[model samples]
Target chain A: MERVPVLKIGDILLVSIQIDMEDQVALQLQEDLAERIVATGVHGVIIDISALDIVDSFVGRTLATIAAVSRVLDAETVVVGMRPAVAITLVELGLSLPGIRTALNVELGIALLGKRDVGDEPADDEDEDDPAAVTTS
Target chain B: MERVPVLKIGDILLVSIQIDMEDQVALQLQEDLAERIVATGVHGVIIDISALDIVDSFVGRTLATIAAVSRVLDAETVVVGMRPAVAITLVELGLSLPGIRTALNVELGIALLGKRDVGDEPADDEDEDDPAAVTTS
Candidate 1:
């Protein structure tokens, strides 16, 4: 049985990975995320990776895949907290995440989930700087 | 009250932004995060910023500040889901996030939350990398 790395933080599932995260783990994680999204019926997800020493292109893509799956399952995904060194390495490696949602921290990610979709013409409580608020700015 | 840029998905917070992220916001966010940790009692934290076109020294420092607050609050922080362009720009601008946690995406970030506090121990299930096993390589 493949193990999907994650933990339950209240009703939300908090996934924090400490390994190198090669292709195998990424695939397994994607599958697990899909299943979990359906079972939990929870639209919120927080992915925390503060322990990795390195992240390659494959890892970045896999993360994006999970985000896509989450959306299909009617769940929202938030990628949070990052180390500066790893961030630099990933960018330098030219890893691009095209259809993924991200937040500066889990708190923000949760905040994102609460936001009214743009189609609804957001209320004044809207933050002008919000990415979703500004249409991919 | 000052409005912080945030992406809310349903009730979940996707991303929180303190753009221009001056020291004051940094301090406030620290307090905010601390309060949140105490309130939610959930130790998982993810910071995402695929929106910020540029991350200056102040922004870098602010992220570090948030990470510190999370630790003090007994919460784990992982910054994830940054674009390669933004990562490179931060790195080139000589802005570095010291002592902050980061991952390529939310899934990895979430995965990091469940890891042991020490060295990289293999995940209980997704450790097999043999050719016969799942292969995306």
Candidate 2:
């Protein structure tokens, strides 16, 4: 039974799934992430799965479950860094992994979480000058 | 004050914002949409913004607000058919409109909303032989 480590950076929780993501491991990660979200009072959770060569239906469902649980706890979950083949596989498996947010990478995931917060800012609601800082190749 | 019409299609509410969104009009649409969601007991909302040439910060924020509000009311909001220029304007204005789901068109938006409900479905969690029905250009 391998345990996934949950890291806290600033106000967000970062979980990078580096292992093979067995059934038990996936369930464990889901439970651990929920508890971490509550204990740390973090508003954002980023699960980087770039290292995963394959995301089966179980792993895909686990990610979607973690996202739903995070939402219920008033926290947001972003599943970033999915490989193209894995994405195609998930689509083929009929697991769209709905209710899950994604980004091309961890940096974009963080920016997306922060971007939502900026939307609620009263002062910058009318600010027309954003640096257009997001540049992806 | 012109009102944005919210049409009920099956179990979803479709709001096509064809008019120029003045401040009052946007606010009214927000309030109207909330009421309609409650009245219709629908779980999905599709906002069509394809006709608008300009989607300023105010309109963008209003869209975000509608999304947040719909989520609170247990309804998912998907903004569809946004012109590329409007999207560029939103990014440049620093209003990422986070926490909102988007689709390229109304048909895709419906598919996205339907995709989430399939996630919670327990029976097909492991089904791998899907037809791969989703074909996007």
Candidate 3:
């Protein structure tokens, strides 16, 4: 019964699941995350699953539950570093995991949470799309 | 002064934007979406933006706002049919439109919303991942 370590980094909780999680372990991680979020008062949680080659329905549901819980606690959860195969398997499993945000990697996940903190809407607006489109088309 | 027509099919509100939307028109669509969400009590909203070749920051922000508003009224919103070029442009412009779910096309968008309606968590679970892993790895 290995406990998933939840590391706190600059207002974000990083959970890198390195173990092949059992059902009980997934539930334990869920409980651990809720407590960590409340204790640290972090604004974001990045779950790095790059090492994971498989994600069944139970784990997928746990991730979604974690996202929903983190949202309630005012913390954004981003699942990062998902392999293409895992993504395909999840879709094939019919588990899209709505209410969850994802990033290609940890760096992008941090950027996404940071951008979300700047404003309610997405940031960095140049308003040049129209002008650029005019010349291209 | 073109109006974005929101069609009601089954329990979903389909907003297919087939025009070169002005800023005012985008805002109008936002208001129209909110009204339609409350008026029809649809379970979902499918915003089709495949027709538009370009999307500025204003339009992106409007889409986010629409998602937020529709959520408040208890309807899920999914943006569909985004071209690859438009996606690249949106990322370059720095607007990811958080809180809005997206699918590749209208059929997939409808499937996403339909799947969401069946249950709070994703449906269709066959827990053979362990057995599948047994042979592969």
Candidate 4:
């Protein structure tokens, strides 16, 4: 049984799926990722699936499961580098993968994680020039 | 003085925001979009924001508003091509832009709209092979 490797980059965990995953492999990855997220106390997890050409509902649900688990452990999950075909297929399969933040690639994923760490400071700087930054509530 | 163009793509309407928008402009686009959705009887609306670098809370709310209005008008809205910086900024501002389907780019956004038109037919085909495809309801 091949296990997906979870690499810790600073305070974030990175999981790059390099092959077509079987159902069992996907489920194993989900469990492995959840345990690592709790053990490492990481603030973010970036799952890169750029290499995958097909993402059936099982794989999609596993990704969603990993994301939900990470959130409960105080980590945000960003699934990046999804191919256009795979995205179309996922949506067509009626799985929107909600509550999962996504980006075009790993670099942007890292940037998104970093921005969350900084919180509202960067947005505040821009607020000086843009008055509409006022929250509508 | 520039108004966002809403082009009719078959039964779906496409509104590609081509520039960084002010609060008022964003609000106007939301209104224009709602009116168009009702007037045109389109099944879906794709709002492309690939050009935007910053999406403050006001703009984020407007996007949500458009999605809500479209739903009431029997139209689905897919917001596409959000810059990573903008996404990070929006999340930091406490606005997830919920109730809006998002795609990586315009092409995928269009594809998503098309899939919704077909509804669950394609998803049903894969259900036979995958037992987990059972909708959790």
Best first by lDDT, ranked = 2, 3, 4, 1
Name the docking class for model 4: incorrect
Model 2 lDDT per residue over A7-108, tens place? 565577777675667789888888888998889788899888765778888788888889999977878899887879988988999988898999987677
- On lDDT, the candidate that comes out on top is 2
DockQ of prediction 4: 0.01
Q: Summarize candidate 4's per-residue lDDT along B1-137 as a digit string, tens digits.
A: 44555655456676656445666777777788888877877778877675566787767877888898887777889998788998888888888888899988656776787777344344343524667667889
* Alpha-carbon lDDT, every model: 0.62, 0.78, 0.78, 0.75
Residue pairs in clash, model 2 = none
The positional error of residue B13 in candidate 3, measured at the CA in angstroms, is 46
For candidate 4, write residues A38-122 as lDDT tens digits.
8978888988876577888878878888898888887889998888999999889998998888988766887777777432343
Compared with the true structure, the alpha-carbon lDDT of candidate 1 equals 0.62
TM-score of each: 0.43, 0.44, 0.44, 0.44
Residue B14 shift from truth in candidate 3, angstroms: 45
Look at candidate 4 and give me any clashing residue pairs. none
- Give candidate 2's error at residue A22 in angstroms: 64
* Model 1 alpha-carbon miss at residue B97, Å: 38
Instruction: Go through the candidates in order and give the C-alpha RMSD of each one to the true structure.
Output: 20.0, 23.2, 24.9, 22.7
Q: Write the per-residue lDDT of candidate 3 for residues A10-122, one digit (tens) a residue.
A: 67776766555788878888899999899978889988876577888878988999999998888889998788999999999999989788888777788778866432654
Per-residue lDDT tens digits of candidate 1, residues B44-109? 677765435667777777788777877666666788766688888888987767777788766566
